[model samples]
Target chain A: MTQSHLAPEVMARARDIVALYPHPRSALIPLCHLAQEQDGWLRPEAMAEIAELVGITPAEVLGTASFYDMLHTEEVGTYVVTLCTNIACMLRGAYELLHHAEESLGIRTGSTTADGVFTLEDAECLADCGRAPCLQVNHRFFGDVSPEGFDKIVDDLRAGRLADEVPHHGTLVRTERDGGLRVEAETITAERRATAAAMAERAATAAAASEAKANG
Target chain B: MTVTDAPKIVTSRLGYDDSHTLERYLATGGYEGLRKALSMTPEDVAKEVDAVSLLGRGGAGFPAGRKWSMLRKAPTSYLVVNGDESEPATFKDHLLIERDPHQLVEGVVIACYALQVTTAFIYIRGEFALGLERVTAAVNDAYGHGAIGRDIFGSGFSIDIVVHPGAGAYICGEETALLESLEGKRGFPRIKPPYFPAAIGLYGEPTVVNNVETLSNLPWVLSNGSAAFTALGEGRSTGTRLFALAGHVKNPGVYEVEMVKTTFRDLIYAPVLGGGIPGGRELKAFIPGGASAPWFGPDQVELPLGQDEVGAAGSMLGSGSVVVMDDSTCVVRAAWRITRFFWRESCGQCTPCREGSGWLEKILRRIEDGEGRESDLELLMDISDNLAPGVSWPPQQTTICVLGSSIPSSIASAIRMFRDEFLLHIKDGSCPQGPAPHG
Candidate 1:
């Protein structure tokens, strides 16, 4: 990845991003974003070119690129599964889910399966502690999984049963105050219809009270 | 408690039963410092800060007063209070901001006056939305009482204070990096030399950055005078520092102590302070300054709990956030957890920090899981060495920030001090130090 090889448009955008900061070298991370956007993954050659563009050494570029899990320094599969295994996720059997993922995919952490379908990596806290045992396939999160359930999810991905319409986990079933389940709608359902009716009743009651006060 | 007996300054403003409301704060001599500062010239105030030699409590330990004096001689210099206390195990700044909002506001006004700046921003942590409201209310109350804004105490100095919440990036705690975040950009730290905040900061004018506690000390210093403020601590590192104590201690909370007066044993073993190790377990290792500072084993426990003393012991008095670990706590687990934090928060700016921290985290994880080779320890050392006290090309003298340097310091020290414990995990393929289940 020589400076000469960068697409002229990508190089221009990288330069512009670097120029935003007072010091150009401070733009290293953002430039990597530009490079990744251009090349899909951070190639060593592209990183070297970015280093030259940002007035830093290639080693520095490589270091910054590899530091974050989000940045893909190598080729990745079409779908990326990032599992959150920080303290909260760990307490909720995230490790079981991770192991299940490896077994299903026939690939270890940091590797893409031979089928070129999925890439898996252990992620840090994603700020979704409320929904423990969560994993994000690309941009969507699949939360609250048992070991067998996680295995089924990977199988569904492998089978193409779940279409890639922006990968998402199932609806989050929140625990209500009285220890009952309150399922918020991730998909349109009869339960969602009941919730809507209850909300409408409350709104009508408030409106009627306001109307009565105006008449008085 | 008598002033001499009670470690004065940082915790002086903290009361267990104190309400954070403006009325409660005012009833307790909160605005006295602001009044005293308003009565004097800004230059005189700056000079007084220079006299006390107070340092920033946000890890760097840069002299607070000296920082104020460095602001460009412009009509509109800015004072930014760094309340982004993002270091793991550091919670003292949040306590002051939440429990004593007016005290922080008073400190801000005094600092703004000293720097000859009418506009100030409290760069708060994004997660501290509750804290933001408390500070905002305090600022409004001060305005209503003429303690801030135009014609404060009949003085011509008018100060406007605003709370700017950050997007919760740990790197923003660094002074230069903080300035970048405040400008509504990604919180990436800029290299120094070509760009120092004092000269070209926050819209390319002069800006003064002070820690929340450092600014909070301003009002007291202005009221008591420099000599009195300096009298409280040792030479050079004058004034009181807030130490946030946590982990395995019976009574873990923030304590205010003079810089040179406190000892490690007194702080940790004193029943009212940290209450020694929990459940009578012997102390194994301790982190003196949040997660970034180097770890100290039991043999190093006798070292005094002061800035100079701690630094001489090959660690820092960073933010004064002390975390203690007992015998049951696995050193390997602790190192792995702290390394993971750095890896997650690396910002991916510098190569050594980004790649090095992730590698270290992965290696530590491997060691904790009993899959580590003997050479893995050597590899960890090599990676950490590259991250700290080493020059990088483009010739940046140190790691990208103190964060990069400090993360490795804790890991390397933990490995050096407790190799047997780490080796046990590798040999047994399980954590022998894992805590027993509660009844």
Candidate 2:
């Protein structure tokens, strides 16, 4: 590699992620997600940097990146707009939203605007069946969007009126777990184990008998 | 007549105050099942699940207890919870993870305790940002309460759950592909017969891969008796299922229905379910399952919404995603859209899926774009035959995974059901009804 592209802190976090799994190679996808979040896309240099961190070749990294759809191998715009045009969305005016987006942005489905601000693409199902015609800006969900709604969001985004709507790549929602954890010391007596073992023997025999009857 | 609406088991706490929090989950007696399972032996826990006849809710409807029984007894077994709800029109698992994240964690704790598994992974879909965040925080909250870490509930049972997000691959919903993605590889389906996840999966150890909804039912099965769980439905298809109703319905949302109790008519026309088709239009056809499932005519609306009945009616109850299409919808265009999904999502590992899906899309696009020949109809069927090679309900194909069959299921069914529509396109050189179906 020419020079170390990843920041020192990013590299330190990458090492910690690698340490999470027993096999370091299992951290390849997470590390790639980290690099893309930093660079907005997976650049060749970023791939090389990740390969160094994960102890694998750059080609190995590319092979995995190319397989997944979200990992961009090339440069993307600042705001990546992905509209779900799959079956459920299509039934609820997704094509209209896509066509409206194409006309308003002056770009095709898979192309970016000339200003390098918006990249538009038709995505598959976003798993928001309740809200059809959904779209995502940098993977954040905007459900039940109409053409007018689409234009309004774009206008707000361009004008910086709604900055928090579009987060950086790979950043999802922001929520933390609450503190009232349930733990009791008196419940763990030796008597419970004996009762549990006897129940297990009866359950196993019943399961075996049922298995035989089903096979028969 | 509509089937009586049963109480929501999975979504019971959906709209409760602080539903996604560990506090609310605890107040509702969430980890009581895990605590009970920890008190019992692992085999008994598996038996309790088996007794309930809880089928995998992530499509395929395989018995969860049978899957647990097939564990290879390896010392290093792993539990993989599939939250990759990417089946088009399906979002029940997404709701489960977002609304009741700790419910899934509690299920994982019990499952790992039963299988003696230490390491478990929740493979959430990459597109699901809210789900990922909710599940991540839930895992942390679980750890804080000693619900997931060593000596859970002070029962000396240890399990750790890692929330791993997928990077935009629809095929990763397949259990084998999910395992491959967990190993940091391309999400490709492993060949069967030798590579079942139970025998060899996730770092070459015995693995149990259960769907999010399937695992979420564990706490219920362990808390209530197996007979109580089974009494909710009929026959082998017992327990409640989360049905994601979308498309031309007035109320397009997820509903929990007893497996054998609910019917297609109830899901589509019942006021409590789909609220009947939108605009009061006559239902022409609908996908009984996800897009991969074949389209069924309105005559089959009375069919029960279960695996056996739906499969007998020539469509699998896949992911329980019902996408209704009114008479205003064009059948040929719908088939093309579904076919294009399979074509794009094909992993390119198998020849039939890679090449066959693309060719089917091109032909359908040509037919839809008003540049069609009568022979293109025969050509589409021929291409479908080459991919699946049978007209059976579950076509006998030669691809690595069901994704190969998915390419032809919608196409073959559309041609069989709407030959006149295809002929009209060829006759008029376009969609006879309109110009390319705007919206």
Candidate 3:
């Protein structure tokens, strides 16, 4: 699985994502996601490729990638079980549920199982508060779960019964979009010039205001 | 009109199975608002929104129309739809996006028309995989149906919407931080004064950042007119609003109700709403707003869900999330969990928020685990007050964003309301209430 280059298809998709933004540097986070999708973890070579794609250094890519919890710099197991222990979930036996997940998965909250098939995390709120004690299997949600319900979910996932609904790690947005407007070459050029002029004017105005305050 | 009598506006199309599709959306009188908005001038459309007095639903209760008015007019102003609903127990936007995405898409196009902008971006949280998929499919379907892209609906107004996905970071929900993330950088919130989206924003250009729920109401506003919406709810809190009810309630879900007409008691106890606490247990306390708000005891249940009313009563109806706690619940554990969330999501841009959140969480956890001194409570107050002086509801912080100040809310509220319970944990050296949680 180790490689110095991103797969040809992923490179093509990366180029498409880059087109959606006005600046190539704006594509760094999405390219990081793309690299994670290609490999389970963000490999050094993949990060180098992304840095080259977005016109930044590899260290800069790593610095930004490390800031996010979803973009893993380290390797993750097959099923990343992220359980919520926030206020809403905690009010609903989330601690007990978390304890159950630890026991059944044979790993601690931030550790991986022996088979490397599952990595459990005590996540913050996933924003689905109605379904308390909610957990995610590689970012897909399961809610209103009890300790027994958690065990059953693990069993189903282990036996590959829920493979159709759940995909591998780093696989977000199962559906593809119909492509963005991407403005148009003429509009992009025009908008870029307009934005540059506005920024220059704004800087000039700020400098004048500061100078006036100093004089007073 | 009262809460029970007010008409459903934003959530009018929910509960239908095929509500997300363009076919079902067109069949159900969707995008008619866009058609009607196209017939009028952009100024007139903004005038309709101004007449409605709709407040922003993303924590801060600023008026949406006034926010649009403040946007610096330029040839290339951008409109960003903030669907990054990352706060705990705040899921109204999640529901609006998951079930009725076409409505949201229609709302975005309508907003673009009012702002007279040609490009927009819908930044949804990354954890919402299905919601992201549905909204993406809806945007594509919208393009195919000729509701978006060049010369929309043959009115010669062109617009482009990019469905941007966030890699998991809660701080990106902040509008300025969202812009930073959109530009592919760490999501540290920018300082205000010159950084308010109306002045300097995304890519150093003027931008209008509207919450998902606020924009979702635009279709209804245009469809029924501003007078129709303003007539439903009274005073500053005009039009119906969505509230996400969670925690100990039996029917914990999102409900669209009138703004000032509804009281906390009705929302938490109504048969069709929260459906009361489970197991016939008595209510102990509740968080009237989102997790960041101070907790309210049972006596404050009669206060109406109005921004002015709640603010006068020493809290805010932030993010429209109400969490209830039954008599069996442990207040210390609940407060500790909330503090823990703030600690995890502090973004580390400021020393007060990052370091303060961690210290607060550690101390709350210790007290919850019955390893507390009576003086630990005072120490908690001292640590919290250092971050936000006075430890009051309208927070004053030592850091850039309000998150640093928000660290004090739960602990301060717990100490103010239930000082004796913390003493019991300290005196008895164990939790008297035990692990009594709700689902």
Best-matching candidate per lDDT: 3
Candidate 2: interface RMSD equals 3.6
- Write the residue-wise lDDT of candidate 3 on B109-130 in tens digits: 9989999988898998888889
DockQ comparisons of all candidates to the true complex: 0.03, 0.34, 0.44
lDDT of 2 by residue, A69-129 (tens): 8899988888889999888898898888899999999998888888889999888899886
Looking at model 1 chain A, report the run of 10 residues with the lowest lDDT sum: A171-180
- Report the C-alpha lDDT of model 1 over B273-361, residue by residue, as the tens digit: 77787677898888887677778878876776567778777778887877777887767877887788788788778888888888998
- lDDT string for model 1 (A1-216, tens) is 434757887677567555444456655655665565566567888888877877777887776556444457788876777786654355445666787778777888888888677888876544334355666675355666677777777778768877643332211111111111123456558768889999999999999999999999
Q: Pick out the ten consecutive residues of candidate 1 chain B with the lowest summed lDDT.
A: B389-398
Alpha-carbon shift of residue B116 in model 3 (angstroms): 1.3
Error of 3 at B182 (Å): 1.1
Q: Candidate 3, A37: how far from true, in Å?
A: 1.6
Question: Per-residue alpha-carbon lDDT of model 3 for A55-160, expressed as tens digits?
Answer: 8999988998887888899999888899988878888878889988888887888888989889999888888889998999988999999999999999999999
| Native-to-model Cα distance after best TM-score fit, residue A84 in candidate 3, in Å | 0.8
Q: What is the C-alpha RMSD of each candidate to the true structure, in Å?
A: 17.3, 10.7, 7.3
What C-alpha lDDT, on a 0 to 100 scale, does residue A33 get in candidate 3?
Answer: 76
- What candidate 3 gets wrong by more than 4 Å, as runs, is A1-4, A182-216, B1-3, B433-439
